[model samples]
Target: MLNRLFLPSIFALLIYGFWVSAEFKVIAAGVAVFLMGMVYLEKGFKLYTGGLLENILKKTTSTLFKSVSFGLATTSLLQSSSLVSVIVISFLSAGLIGLETAVGIIFGANLGSTAGAWLLAVFGLKIDLSSYAMPMLVFGLLLNTRAAKPLKGMGYILIGVAFLFLGIHYMKEGFDKFQSSIDLSAFHIDGIYGILVYTFLGAAATVIMQSTNALMVLVFSALAVGQLDYVNSLAIVIGSNIGTTVTTVIGAIGANAQGKRLAAAHLLFNVVTAIVGVVALNPLMVTVDEIATLFGIHPHDYTLKLAIFHSLFNIIGIALFIPFIKLLVKWLKSLFNDSYSKEPLNLAKIDESSMERAIYLNPAVLSYPDAAMRALTKESGRLYRNTLELICYGIYFSGEQLRNTDNLSELAENWEKEEQPWSIKGLYIRHIKGIYADIIHFAGALEGNLPRQQAQELFALKVACRNFVQAIKHVKHIYKNMGKYIESENDEIRHQYNQLRLCLASVLKLVDILGVRRNYNHIQEHAAQLKLELHEQDQQTYSTLNKLIRSEQVDSYMASSLLNDSAHVHDACTNLIDGAVIMITRDREEYREYDLAGFTPAAQKTSS
Candidate 1:
């Protein structure tokens, strides 16, 4: 509703302004071009999103100071606090960085925005950026036609820069022309109400324009042309600072609870900063003038003074809040609990039509490769858990038995005297197929955009999904026999079947250990060791089968059934081990090709 009401109202105002004064067209054109440039700029940056920026954000956000520096630097380069804020929101949603880190970045971005003010005031207002803009636009559009992604991204960035230049030029020219027709100084008011009114106007304009950098350009250009009072423009700056959070707030709407918490923190920081700037308005202005004088800025050059004031305001805000970040984070966590988390669904209870879907795979996280990659891995882990559950229930091994260190031999035994075993095939279609398809579809959509490292990571996830399904298929193939013979009247077959169950339970136990532990070397160690154990188990099972057949303790038919079922058991073990390793391990190394663990299951023939 705000979008609907706001856009039409803005258009109406622009149209009326154009009718009243032709200069309004040039100003409006500048804002439009500037906004378009910002869009291109953000897109250009995002094109490189898969690994480069994401890895940096993850590593650098370890401390409050580092997070703030990253925010400030990126916002300075990007030239739009709004874009920076939104990107931070996406990062937060992906679970890459914490709320404290995110808030630090946002606070720093406010300071970074002042860099744009300094550039515009000192250079943008005085120089003919239009000349530079023309060449950039030409070069950018030409490169944009290239097929390579790097070239395309550079082109978009150039075009964005060009548009920003042209925009500033047009706005300056418009205001210059407007000074002759009407003195905007006449519209300027004084006192507390005036300060409040102008501040609100600045914030409202920023929210509507969706770029505080653009709003700053407008304010600076208008002030340069005597169309705005220096004090009034400063008030607008305060408002613009508050309004910058709008972009983050909007971005967070579709994100997870973590994203919303970060957005709230951004809003809180800016609002508090605005309040400080307002209450200390006179003193800050005095300080700005003093700083301006110290730096040899002419007394009449309010634009430069405004830049100093902008930087000072944010600096003061950061200084005031940096110490309390931990406390703030604790409060935020209390305020925004993880109520978004869903209750774990029982695989046995799910309807085939309404099988589980991806939890972490949301459209909001897809904007950044790092976020999307993390989310994919997380969702795959969830699927792995569900598959484990289905495998346990299908084979008549109690799920609860796998939780602790009860003897594997004891846990492996089928405790149920009489119970309905879930159909493994039914569980696959009902629980695995839909979620697997969703993961596949999501991964497919992200194929080309990722860097080699990120792409490979994404591929690892797909392979894990396939292997998981393959594991299920192997279980499904042997499900009926395992259920029938676990309590068979024949002692030899029952003991052998229990041994097969123990083999599976052992592998499941390692997988459970991998899931809980975060030590990578230990995971690799355990995964390699499990493969060895499965290989040993395969040899032992073969020997036992031969012994049973030769002694005639089991019939030829039972021997043949055991032979076929053993192969299925071996394949299933291989699948679970390999798949679990891939799902958990970040560095795949050459371990994925360990022995015969990468065996292609019979499910490979199906049109998955």
Candidate 2:
């Protein structure tokens, strides 16, 4: 509803402004062009998102000071606090960085944003930039047409810079011309009332434009043209500072609870900063003037003074809040608890027709490769848990019993005594299929910015999901026959089917242990032992089947069904073990030992 109203209103305002003054139209056009340039500039920077920026972010955010410095340096270089905010939120959602570190980055981003004002005030207004813009636009356009992706990205950046310069030039010219016909200075308010009103206007302009850097550029250009008073400009700066959080808020809308908490922290930080700036407006202005005088800047240079004020207030905000980052994180956690913490384990209550939405995967995290990889890995873990449940229940044993350290034979005996009417297809449709589909869809949606190593990891995860689903299907194939034979009056057939259940259940138990064991050496050791045990079990099962058939205890049909069903069970166990190995090992070095061991299943070795 707000979007519906906001668009038409903006259009109407633009039309009215153009009708009232040709100068207004030129200024509006300049703002439009500059915003477009910002879009291109952000796009160009994204080309480097694959691993370089993500790695730097991961490394730099270890300490609060480093996080702040990273935020400051990144925003200063990019000249877009909104981009920094988005990256911070992405990292937070992906669990790559803690919330306190994310807040620190945001605080530094606020300080770093002031650099744009300084750049424009010190150089943009002092010289004619239009002369430089023409050549930049020419080169940028040429580069944009290049075949290489990086070259094209560079071209877009060049064009963006050219557009920014041209836009500033046009805005200055239009505002200067408008000063002759209309004195915006006449409308300037004084005292607290004026500060509040102009601050709101500043925030509203930024919210509408969705770029504080653009808004600052306009403010500086207007100030240079004598169309905006120094006091009013400061008010607008305060408002713009507060307004910058809108982008992050919007980005967090579809994110997980952690993302929302980070976004809330961002908004809280900015609001506090804005409030302090407004309350201390007079004192800060005096400080800005004093700093200006110390640096040999002319007292009459309001543009430069405004830049100093912008940095000064943000620095004060950072200094005031830096010590309390932990408290802020604690507060945010209390406010927004983890969304998945309370998920019900009742399989019977699952909605069969509902699309299983991704719990960890969100588009907001896609721009940061590290974050994207983390989200995908976490989602895969969720899928594995659900699939584990389905597999356990399909075998007539409850997932709880399989996960526990109880004897598999005892658990299978206890379950067999009851009338277990398990529905493998219903469970697969209700619990497994939806999550598997979601995982596949999320993997397909990942951006190409992921590092090659991370990309391979993602592929491994997808393959794990596939292997798990295949394991379920194999189990489904044997479930009916196992169920019928387990209740048979024939003692030999009933015993054989029970052994099949025990074998599969033992594999499930080992997998449960593998999922929780963290030590690298221990996991590899256990996995090796498990491979041997499964191999021994397969040999024993075949031996028993041959004895029963030779002794005439089982008919040919019974022997054939037992052999095929046993193979299905073996195949399912092998797939589950392979998938577990992939999920547990962190790196190729850890995987090398397993690969060298060449622990192929008997069926595969025999077939080959």
Candidate 3:
């Protein structure tokens, strides 16, 4: 309800303000332009995300200190903590970085964000930045029209900087004009009550603006013009710091649970810092003054003093929180768990409708290449397992029987005494089809949005998914005949079909092990082993069929049926092994089926 009313209420309020005061209109326009500049800046940085930024994150996120340093440096340069937060959230969702490292980055970003306040205070109030805007905008627009991505990214950065300068100039001008017309200082409340009221107003403003940098610049503008007091401005800074988490929280709404946890951690860090800043305002201000002196800052320059205070308080927050990040992560995980968070498998709680969908495949992950690839890989793993289940059920067997049973002959002999059959078609529709479609659709959507190597990875994943689908088709063709002949009166026919099931089962067991035992040698060994065994089974099927035919132990009809079914078994098993190898090894030539390239023909003949 509040969300529904928020936009109209804000619109009405802005309209009323515009009607009443020309100064208010200018200030609001400045804020709007500043926000637009920030958006451009974020976009500019994101165009460069997958290369240097992604590499830096991977290398630096190993330790809390390194993570904090990375966050501080990036935020200092980019001047957008929101951009850093987005990157962190994407990495967290992708399982690229740990929650502790993410929390540390958030802590450092708060400190780094204070650099913006310093930049605006020191330069924005002193210079006529409007003089710098025009040339930047012209160059930016020209480069923006270029086809090259790097040129386009540079263009956005220049344009964004120009708008920021323009916005600051207007805000400074508006505040000067507004101060002459009416004294906002006359309405200021004193001491604790003043701090409380102003802080609440600041937080509300940030929530509406959805930006700390813009809010800081606006406050700095008013402070420079002597329309707002330093003490109240400090309270507002605290409020703005707390309010910044709103952007992080909103960004996480469509993200995975890991992203949400990082969002919560951001809120907690900011709120704690805000609380410390509020409770120890006098002592902290004294500390800020002392720190300002060390840097030769004029004691009367409240704008620089405010910047010092902002950086100091955030540093204090980091000093307080860094030691306990692990405990915090543990608590947050306990509070929130994803449906797919139960480690390797055990995804999809299996609804009453008997339908299943992709678990790791959320839209929020699509913006980042690493996140998107990881999500697809995890979803494909689930698809492989589900396809295995469907194939096993199609042929009158269970995964448990495939893995555990040693006496497959006895199990097959007793098939006639079993209960009624179920439809492989219905089973696939219920479970496998939805998941497969989601995987394929997501991969297709991700195409052209990735780097060259990652795009190749996406293509390999699609091919693996296709292989799984083909395996299902082959199994569906043999399913009916298996059901009919497993109950055959003739023992020889039943035995031959039973052997076919065992052949397929052998491949299933190998694929199943791929999920459990993640060793490199195991993947190579199992893959090569399946190829040789399946080929030997093919030879044995042909040899046994000829013996049964020539001895007239089987009629032509039975012989033809066995021949067709054996070929289907070979094809199905081949597809299963191929798909499993591709999905597990992730298209790496070394780990893939080419590892079986060294198999000897003599060894195959010996196995037969």
Q: Per-residue CA lDDT of candidate 2, range 1-608, in tens?
A: 98899899999999999999998988998898889888888888887666678788878888999999999999998889998888878777766777888888888899999988988999988898889999999999999999787998899899988988988888888888988888888998988999999999999999999998889888998898788889999999999988899999998988778889978988888899999999999999899988998999999999999999999989998988888888888888999877454453445344445435567777777765666877788777777787777776666666766766467776666664444443788777766787788778877778365545666667767767887999999999987887688889999999888888888888777777767874556665666677788788879978998899899999999888988988888888878877877777644453322221244323233434
- What is residue 431's positional error in candidate 2, in angstroms? 4.5
Task: Estimate the lDDT of model 2.
Answer: 0.81
C-alpha TM-score for every candidate: 0.83, 0.84, 0.84
* lDDT of prediction 1: 0.82
| Tens-digit lDDT string for candidate 1 (346-427) | 5444444555566456566667777788878877877887788778776775555577556887655537644554567666
lDDT of 2 at 225: 78
Alpha carbon lDDT of each predicted model: 0.82, 0.81, 0.80
lDDT, candidate 3, at 365: 60
- Candidate with the larger TM-score of 1 and 2: 2
User: Using lDDT as the measure, which candidate wins?
Assistant: 1
Q: How displaced is residue 360 in candidate 1, in Å?
A: 3.3
What TM-score does model 3 achieve against the real structure?
0.84
Q: How accurate is candidate 3 locally (lDDT)?
A: 0.80
Residue 122 alpha-carbon offset, candidate 3, angstroms? 2.6
Q: Report clash pairs, candidate 1.
A: none
